[model samples]
Target: MPDDTVCDMWEVQRGFDELGRPLRDITFCVVDLETTGASVKAGDRITEIGAVKVRGGEVLAEFQTFVDPGTPVPPEITALTGITDRLLYGAPRIESALPTFLEFAHGTVLVAHNAPFDTGFLKHACADAGWAWPKFEVVDTAVLARRVLSRDEAPNCRLGTLARLFQTETTPNHRALEDARATVEVLHGLFSRIGGLGVQTLEELQAYSAKVTDAQRRKRGLADRLPDKPGVYLFRDDRDRVLYVGMSRNLRRRVRTYFTSSEKRSKMGQMVNLAHHVQGIECATDTEAAIRELRLIAEHAPRFNRRSRRQRRLHYVVLTQEPWPRLSIVRRLPRGEPGIGPFGRKELALAALEAIQETFPVRTCTDRFGRVPTRSRCLAADLGTCLAPCEGSVTPETYAALIRRVSEAMTVGAVDVVDALSRRMTIESDLERFEVAATHRDRLSAFSTAAMRSSRLTSIRTCPELIAARRCDDGRWQVHVIRYGRLAAAGVIPVDASAPAYVEALRALAESTDERDERTTVEESETLLRWLESPGVRLVDVVGAWACPVIVDPGGPLVELAG
Candidate 1:
């Protein structure tokens, strides 16, 4: 059994799996409001409330009322809405009418021609009346009309225009109940058009009506058959070339967003336009899904994906192997060599190298020296920046000592180096050399970040095999088999099965991994390390040693600098 704390963490839901209720089964409350003014913040109040609830094209109920605004209705409002102050003399005030309308619209999808206008006023009324507003899924028929109908089909998205387009029995006459009735007809007409594009669920309808392009809206059919499961998805062009790759806990919902206004990336819109099909590969665990995404992105080199494609170009700061060793940046780390990084950018690697040089007396010159010392010194040596090892002033043994210190600082905890740099920073501050102090602070930060990242990657990569399990929201256990920081296999333990036996069987069938194969990238290892440290993850088994070095103080200057 896991600890009480671990069991308590499992109560937090991971994600939703079920796709929303179907449109035919959902009840829609089409609502409209006549206001004293357009702006809710400028003391506008609802003068009339009207709504019609329908399910499967059948009217279930109707709610209509006139509210007393306590302020005189303007002549313009009377001319527009035909609502007079005398007619509202004996009507209920908004404080009394709001709760009654809310009760009628509760547990139904809220629909209106221009939803923001009506919904905004109602929200303000709820706030003013000291009543908590309910969370209702709002759908705007006007927005949906713009997405479904072109200018040739409908000149405008107004209630009267749509009522004429749909040829509804009730024409909008600026009256709340009549307009709400017309909007109900418009909503059904829009649904009929969207149904041809494979939108049968309320979630799909809401996404289809969002501010997406016509090209993207037409691509909604691509995500119709995707499963609601944890997996990787690929967007393929007409020629079957992958355009983009991604992963999510709910593949269908995540892929559907690519065609919705929620995806604001301009490049994604272009990709969706070019995509001819979408494919989903379901996985048993989210960890497996993440690793598969990284592998697929690396293998496919999809044009739209920006990360993990150039893993070969990652730079590392290494201490060269020579009689007079020096710090150098390389794309590939030599085997059996101690290094400090797998930085994504050369600039970051250079910064980490600079930080190491600033603290230790490591030589900065890029020269190949032999056992016989060359009697030559560079400008860095002349300025006392280097120990002048090439000039034969410093013996080979003394230089070796400096190399050991630098290597220890890179691999082990850099406690002494951090303390030395902190003291130097204080002295520079005392002398009022703020620019120099700032430079030192930045170098220290870069070094600390690189060291911490390398430690995390190394800890995961050095382990031969590791098994872990996390209980899902549905009471099933998601088991993962990881070898050398790569997902070897994955499975799920049923609620009635023993988790330990299931994990053991998975480990027996896991892929054989070679720790020295160089197939595991630094990003993949870091991804595994993060999963291993996340809440609710229980270690089931381990083969080799796994631990990270605690190098920096959590509340030290590094934290302050990061802030």
Candidate 2:
């Protein structure tokens, strides 16, 4: 739990998350390099380095140096840069010059026109000198010009072209210092254009030069009020409808990305266009933020969110309560009934049901049976897949025993079903029926997944209430109160707070629950279980038994079910 490991499970937008700092507060090291050749891999090396550090349109410092390449300068390179072997007679080598440049630009954002060429050469120099390259935030002026200036404003992003367009006092002449000076002017000119589009921070400036649509960029003000903390955010339309919901460790940084090119999803772009405002809900911990996100998404069923919206479609495989028990696929399982799932897909539940039926001599037909059973039998009986209970071939007592086995396979353990399917797969494979073996493998996978999920969910659902705490990266304890697998309350224990008193207060503030049916969704229970079982988590207190049955394997050994 490193301090920087915030929201490890969530996907974060790539780039700097420093959106709070204004562009005027950022010191930029505008750098340019003259190289011996185009490709660094072709034994080319830096001939000269020129950089000007500026902040708020004020020049702070300038760095210029010539590096000896340890070889004769190419004739064409001399023609382009006007530097030759004679001019480099007393220059410092890269090993000496690289450290000085690095020290000069150590804490500033690196800016360059055609950044990759300049930064790539610097990185190569750092590597050759056995120095770890510092991770500097980079802004490319050429890239920004392409994003901000149209062809009518600037014919090309080349240094000479942009210099002429901006009427820069210093013009680029293929020399490092002069080109870098010219780029400073071009950079300022481009920043002014983006400033009108609401790009005010270094992070926003970098994102504005990306593939973000102009329409999306214009809505940057929507993220202005968000706090830089762990929380959930909601995007709302003009009619106050929630278009999307999400959570992040840094709310401001994450929400800001929605209007940037980093959010590449086309549906998100449409959602952003429709969005008129964004709302933030600050939380005490990342876990709390995640749970809040799930609850919000479930509550609103936001159009742009793809998950947790179709809980109604979740299916389960249950043993039907009837005169003659049979495995059935169901949308909802009765309370106190032994069932296998809350499978997200009906096809998956069906596959688990098929696997159970294949393993046991249970009735697959959907018809209800009475004491005086019908004489007619389904095709399964003819195919010898069923015991033909309708024909009175198997006694009621015997059928009940088989039903118990099926229930056990679904509820207590699935080793029997796994063993049966595995044996069949072996026989099918031995007979060279690879495709048939593959089908058996798939069914086994479905059954095992359902059984594992059911076991995990049942363990948490049966518990009355549990309080768990884990030490955070900052040495504070994150405490959560869970009631019947639902997150009831979450709070943090300060470094100086009393642990028992803090937890007791948190528990008192938790949501109260009655002894009713499991109220938490399967997804929420699974999420809580994962957090509870994660490393370094300690169970502070438990009101009831909170443990899952060991999953047994077919090879005569028991194994703990992985979270």
Candidate 3:
């Protein structure tokens, strides 16, 4: 095979083993191990283990025992397996049982309905006893069943049914011994159905499980598999190249969906064609999943995913970039030199001066040439809100002080910044910086803007912060924040950190902010608010928060729609 596109493991096997022609005579142990759950990594104790050996298609001997699970079995399991907490309360543990079973079945293949569940338990059991895990061949009876019967016709080819298929005459319950016997018979039936072709050795079968589309791969397993949960999954090629990286809320369901539903994912076609490899890392939380997926995508840049572009952006308040840095709004800070910059072109940078006109009724303006225009009580001035720079009610210096307050509200946050400002004003008055302190005194109203001056308002925080778009009941736009403030390690916060499911958070934030925007100090973003209240507004967690009505000279196109 060329180094081409890849198919899943089982798909790869069928490439050569059409119709599953066997390769050689093989000895197998029809085996069963009762464990706590699906994870072999988690210490799940097996209380019972059973094995029936067969060579040349004849019953050889049996190994069966109840090993104390080291922990009490829950009542539900006790009922299912009929292995009570008291039944094995004083029984010999696996350390004692394993040596005997290994010796009896040594050199033979291990077979089970779902081979991984049994083998994983056995491996863990062996490790707990401080023995090296001896690798061996395996045959999954479940896979064999799939090859022999149509699930729709047989509809119920369980171990018991498979025993009937072979006329092995065993109709056992959940006892490990009977199930093992049934599994052995199932394997025999499959072997006979294939014209008594020589079976692969135990080691070969286990290896083939990853590549073959035999009955074992298609049939449902006797053991319950892992649950569906949200997380990230990694798919690797035969050479261990990360073939694909994706995130999903339901981990098991999502992964299986790729294989089980041919229509849902055409990867099955690709998987079958190349018999590729895949494995997964499950994230504990959706946030973690999104973050991990994005990081992996960026790091490896898998062929299947579209790459994200790199751009320098700032969610900030901008004081004019020119002389004395006149105060105003900056919606989005642009890509520019990594410095206190007036980067990009200068026109868009100047448009922020229009904030004194378009947004706030606050009294402030610049001449058409974009300098502080002739003094007039800009609308804000007559309303007693602005210092009336035009009528000389407040001087250029005094007006600039107020602009700083607007900048803070637009940038850091309206409510939080206003609350801090109110406190700072009292402190400044006592210190006789009363004139200077009033810059922080303006009442929070309909709008404001932050000037991109210092890093003070945009410092990376200790915790993940949330910016939400929301719609008020009255159908107005609003934005809100739920900041857990500042985590220790500081760097450019990666945008891909959050998982896809987390996009739901915007609704919650919208509801929270809309309920309290009037009481809080931050001026909510109209765009965000409308987005929140819109029919399909979804909350998205990003590395940083941004407010609209941005005005910055990113050294790009003019009109200043962005910071």
Candidate 4:
């Protein structure tokens, strides 16, 4: 039988110090069991249970119990395990013994020679008793042995053979505690082998034993230099070309996954196979890390990063420059000209244009030079939809007043626009014009979305610098320094830091950042602005103030036709 003291003496030395709890710090519940038969589905029952709770190779506790089978112990089982009805007389039943064993094993990883057989029986017992089982990370010495030991060293990885080959003082004798003790020694031996391969944490140890290819295993060193923090990582090929870019709260853990069997995507497989090096860019906060990832993806245009590789299609609503300024949808805004959108879809942009046309009698004709048309008015003028500016019916000053209202509605998120549309819908419904009411409702939604976008864009465009902070869940303040809509600098300040310390950090961060405003695109600015406006963030300071004018609510009518 396995030596109780030998299992007690086997201690695993520590491994890499990157992320997560070190292997030695983890507690392991080494378990073993003897059953009435081989298969639980065939009505087999556990006869005895043995488990050793160890941390850092020191025995914390031990549990062993005989479970009354409530039936005859088969003669073959009695022969193999030497457990019989006589020995189990008046013993606690399987259901009764499980709770105490589970309590002993709580919050520790369960280790067994053949984990499936041992864990499966325990899971069935829990199900039978209707007890809620705690989530436990299970480790199989059988599986670990296969990865760590060669067939030449041990023809098979059964408990007896492994114990003998590893020269454990104890051997498996079909009894519970002796076999469990032997398995513990085997576990320590395998851990030592994997520790040399850089398996340092419980998570890493589990992931390393997965069905990773030899080629992938050879490249594990690629992740050795990565920092264990929230940041972005770039996977590069032997040619020094970026293959993929990803961000994670734990950079080393995430990068390691790319070369492990856990990466199941075909593209990911190809990327890892070609990857020769990994580069990490550490960030102060997860929010900053995410934003930096967006900026980097845009700049590098990595081939394997399918998303954010191309600019998102955006449309704008601009008032055409003419004596009679009329609303139009455009792809690009003219420099120095005011516009309403970077709308995500052409359909939404068109809807906003139609909404403005329906509410105001702005001229839609393309004519210029303030000349009255010799021809009769077009359909829009004939229907009083326009002021008939092409027919010289409206003065430029009067037309300019109407255009000004449109600008106010779009840029400042003027409440007048939404209120007007709401009232128009209500009036049309009261008049039983359901189709007109529906049109007004759709227009209001489009208009509100556009107004919100315009407000966000305008706030950052007007500011030379914006300093904002949000309290993180960890009690650190996430500080963002933005200049002209682009992220300039970001850092985390301790919530308990003094005023002077905070000011010095802000100054240092600002000085360290190089302005890349020229490379800032619409998406980059929008992403930063969206985060700034998110629920948790509080705007602490601003270099140049941003303000929006109050708009008088237009509640009287939906369609005001005056020119």
Candidate 5:
């Protein structure tokens, strides 16, 4: 202990105690550090450590030293620090410096700006000296500046800012001892602002410091992954448990979604944060990825999955929605359809969508217009591809046909869905809904590219299929079937396969209304295939022998039947 120290100002005995009796109080050491760099891990080394001990608000003793780090001082660091090599030419090493600083700070709390860096350096120094680290509390003035003082008064809580604000002409050098003394002055301004109550305790300051540091690090960009490709991914915890499952086409982009700045507040985000790690499965194509994703979601029943309803039991069924029996996706198993389970909801949706694309397919998903409308120009119309339903280039029934195919494709088929959409696109273009035509065109293009790249189709554009049933007030309940590649909805026909010219009459009925009905009756889908292969006697319902117009293969006029 130096008797001739500069910090001997705070030791006067006060007359008033808690009960108004003469009392003695301990000192607090306002400390500071000069370091070669910011980090404390391996390379950064401390240059100096200084402390000023004060008792009852008056300085009692001073401790300061320049430690000769074994490493050479970096020139850039020396420039910023203003502590050149010559300053430490014969200074004592950390081994000699730590014990002196420890003795000065022994009975008092240690206060500093961003105190962790200083305290951590001291701990390492103590560890080096074979002396056990001191068990003392710490206080960071930065925390107090934020919580107690008005932000405007301490806009920049740096030491220089506080010095200027307090009107203290104490020119701050990067010197450790000088900075320690300047901080004591800064402490006065800061304490005066807080009414000297020290709103935050030493432990609170350390916790605040750790939290702030972590928040800053999180802001610097290792927290999110953003890639735009189709793929499936998994979310796992630190223990390697697959806590959740997810799929995305853009592998990296999808993974980065969890870190969206807005998402952290969501419950899903809390779960994502809980997941300590993630892994991804890349697919060559998006459609495949979409299928795989659906399958995975169902299989895992992940806690954070977005689409999970009606994921299973996607089979051939009917909905009684509109007067014309507007086709809808069948959620429950009807007479047909295969097994469920295995995939997430996405794959389940795809499975039903595939069957409809293949069988009794027709346009189910149409514009607001029942018929395809005609318009002068839309984005699609302007591009010379679609007939805008809004302006009426497409007739209601015709538009309905196109929608039927899209709707049916949604419920059935395994073929590349883009193909069925392409076929519907061609139909729309032929009918003049150029805007819709353009979308179908784009969809077809994407499908063509996808089908080419991957050897699989989401759904194929199979011949449209038709389901006929008697109706009450509504028109004949015809469910455009998903017996082909993709499902499509079309106009209904109320008919009974009986009488002399039954087959001929039905063919005429299907053909006369073929503009819309032709999109129905996908006689080639597995459902129809199985149906046609059944042991029912083939009766030729001979009307006029009209050939199957769209049948490119060696077949005669499309026929209907009677016994």
Candidate 6:
């Protein structure tokens, strides 16, 4: 309040106002410290403190003091900071200096280049002096610079580099007051840079860099309007092109995560930079939201979504149309042929095929010699691994039965073949035929994985109306309504909600779902089963019979039928 004070150049206003206080109206204490060393844990001490209290881009007050560190300054520290021992001969100790600085910075956000370095020393000083440091909000200009400036503009977010880049009126000279003055200029530069990004509030400023802080923060306004409900969200570029598509149980919460530190994918950061807006489509249930997400991703083919961008080219293990129906991998299901899979990988399907061949004497020959052929048997027949229908060695009806068993192995579960392979592997390994044992082991693993995956898909596929419920943390049941393998609806019913009422509601929801016999994506089926199989989930109701021919064990292959 002194008339001769340098801060008299501008009027200082305190407290929030209508229309929310503009960033320019907010007060900030730009601070800097000259320390004897880089770390306080190593007994480093502040030799000098400097802070400039500013509002509306003009200085309101100034605070500066030299502190007697109670130890001689290191020669390197004096060289770096330009604060010699003589300079601090009559300085007040940190205990006294802190109170004066705190008074000047009262009711203001503290800012500094690399804030933690300065704030850490301040907090340590206060605690050492047996005083509680007031919980003042601190902002780091370095973090702001990283968000605002490109690496090309400033190679690093060093205070000196930023001061030079911004061409501040005062140059930092290793002196607290001068460096603080320079930081004040850098702070204003950052504020001006981020203002266009719509960071108008103190809270937004504090959270600016924590989220999509770069030019991507400009899209922060887009997420603000999203409804806080289950929905599909699309991140669109400047031309209104979708950059990414996603689904969330809570639209607002999920969309906001992209802009926050929780989003760690490197490509996501780049995606956000290209995104100019976020659009949300609210759904009646999480199940519907997820389905919508898949459809949107497929439609838009957004460059950012890694999965479900295209209709997957699924591989199926099918019986080769021959006298002896040998197992083979095919990209599409052959008409009128029973097969197992839409397996994601051909190699896996082949492994499943190999396992069936190893277990059953179903011929491995790629010939359609129905009943008999003039040609002789191949290597597989010579090894007795094939029934050799081509040579009239096995009847077509008998080979059909072997093919039927392989189909059963893929659809219901590979229990028989997997068990046989395990015994074979054990015997071979015990005899030290390690190579043969290893082949059996690999085939067993591949067959089990593919068969179980296909079985889960089939289980869901068979259900015309499926309702699964999982217990939420709050004792509510999160129910999913799945019709014809696609998620139709989802809802959370309170534990206290009457069971009759809940079932009736579910019935109504299920009836409203449009049923289609479309092939479900492997990912879609897997996601639903994962949630259903989670520890506390239960099958609440089934309009159509819901059954899995195999019991899924988290630790092993399909053990048995889920009776």
Superposition error at 356 for model 2 (Å): 1.4
Best by lDDT: 2
Better of 1 and 3 by TM-score: 1
Clashes of each: 0, 0, 60, 4, 120, 2
Question: If ranked by lDDT, best first, what sequence of candidates would result?
Answer: 2, 1, 4, 6, 3, 5
Candidate 1 residue lDDT tens string, 1-563? 35663343233333435666799999999999999999988888999999999999999999999999999999999999889999999999999999899999989999988899999999999999888889899999999899889899888888888889999999998888999999999899888998888677887887787777777767877888999898999999999999999999879878988988888898898899889999999988787888889989988999999874678778988889888889999998753477878888888888888888877777887667787767677888777768878778788899899898888777666665577677878999999999888877777777778777766666677788887777776666677888877878998775555555666788889989877857777767778778778887787667887665555566784321110
- Runs off by more than 4 Å, candidate 5: 1-26, 196-563
Model 4 lDDT tens row, 195-313: 88778888887877778888888888888888878899998888988888889888888888877777889888888888889999999877678878887887778888876545656
In model 3, the Cα lDDT at residue 261 comes to 25
Checking candidate 4 for backbone clashes, the offending pairs are 1-171, 2-170, 2-171, 3-170
Off by over 4 Å in 4: 1-19, 284-288, 330-337, 350-354, 361-393, 424-443, 468-479, 491-518, 530-541, 546-563
Q: Which of candidates 2 and 4 reaches a greater lDDT?
A: 2
Which lDDT values do the candidates have, in the order given? 0.82, 0.84, 0.50, 0.77, 0.50, 0.75
Q: What is the C-alpha RMSD of each candidate to the true structure, in Å?
A: 5.1, 6.9, 20.5, 9.8, 27.3, 12.9
lDDT of 3 by residue, 205-268 (tens): 3332333344224422211142445467766666877767777765554454344322233544
Supply the global lDDT for candidate 5. Answer: 0.50
lDDT of 2 by residue, 89-145 (tens): 999999999999999998999999999999999999999878899999999999989
Question: What is the alpha-carbon lDDT for the whole of candidate 1?
Answer: 0.82
Q: Candidate 1: list runs displaced more than 4 Å.
A: 1-16, 19-29, 35-46, 52-63, 68-85, 92-109, 116-137, 145-174, 178-203, 211-214, 308-313, 382-384, 496-498, 554-563
